[model samples]
Target: MDGQYSHDSRKNILEWSLPVIDEKNKSGSLEFSIDGKPNDFFPVHVSFVSKRNFCDIQVAKVTYIEGGSPVRFSSETSFVVDKYEIL
Candidate 1:
């Protein structure tokens, strides 16, 4: 999945998350910062692989500097697919 954020100030923190794969494969979240002048945009990407017949849900949170304060936004999505079988 993908996400984008805009900030009005320099040096802002961004964070996002993906549903936990499991105890064995804990591949769930990410964070980073954008450093630049106002009107800066940042793009984020997330990807994962899972066993057949599995489902996953993901979410994203973006925190940025706006008007000298922190503003936050979030979104979530999910998908499911049947296992592939070859004979």
Candidate 2:
């Protein structure tokens, strides 16, 4: 499967989950904008080094961004979680 890495400055919630083995073996983090403000849940910023395919990525814990902004990867256009290895 093709992998995509990008850097995005979107303020949203990231949902990290296990990779899906089916359907081209594609996977990625679920990024969404915060609908409401002053919420209890805090958005987690993920960063890691990957060597295998995008589907093999290991989703790390939520890291609060210094600027409180979400940045995409640096591979393709979109981010693939199926091959990402959380470091």
Candidate 3:
């Protein structure tokens, strides 16, 4: 993966970005560890991009030609998100 890392100890700031995490379109796992105890990192702020959202519905339409033999498809969705935290 391509990444950029920078940190500022005076401001307690860490910037990390991975531009090319996965280009092959396959699910994978990443594991890492911190030196300190887990409780020391309480109230961490994390964010990521997602295509599917629980509050929104998505639909797709397919056609053989310009609006000819049109077929519509809608996803049968359910509640997601295994864990949620507010801090």
Best by lDDT: 3
Clashing pairs in 1: none
lDDT of 2 by residue, 1-87 (tens): 133333443843343444344576644444445456644454445554334554655544444579656555454333445543432
Instruction: Count backbone clashes in candidate 3.
Output: 0
| All candidates in order of TM-score, best leading | 3, 1, 2
Cα-based RMSD of the predictions, in order? Answer: 20.7, 19.1, 8.8
Tens-digit lDDT string for candidate 1 (4-75):
334433554343334445567544323444457544543433343444224444433444556455456565
lDDT of each: 0.43, 0.46, 0.55
lDDT of 1: 0.43
Badly placed stretches (over 4 Å) of model 1 are 1-20, 23-27, 37-43, 55-87
Ranking by lDDT: 3, 2, 1
Alpha-carbon error at 52 in model 1, in Å? 2.8
lDDT of 3 at 69: 88
lDDT of 3 by residue, 1-87 (tens): 235666676965555555443447333333445577877666566555455564466666667676588776556655455664543
With candidate 2 superimposed using the best TM-score fit, by how many Å does residue 73's alpha carbon deviate from the native?
Answer: 27
Candidate 3: which pairs clash?
A: none
**What TM-score would each prediction reach against the true structure?**
0.21, 0.20, 0.33
Q: Which candidate is the best by TM-score?
A: 3
Segments in model 2 whose C-alpha atoms lie over 4 Å from true places: 1-23, 28-38, 52-87
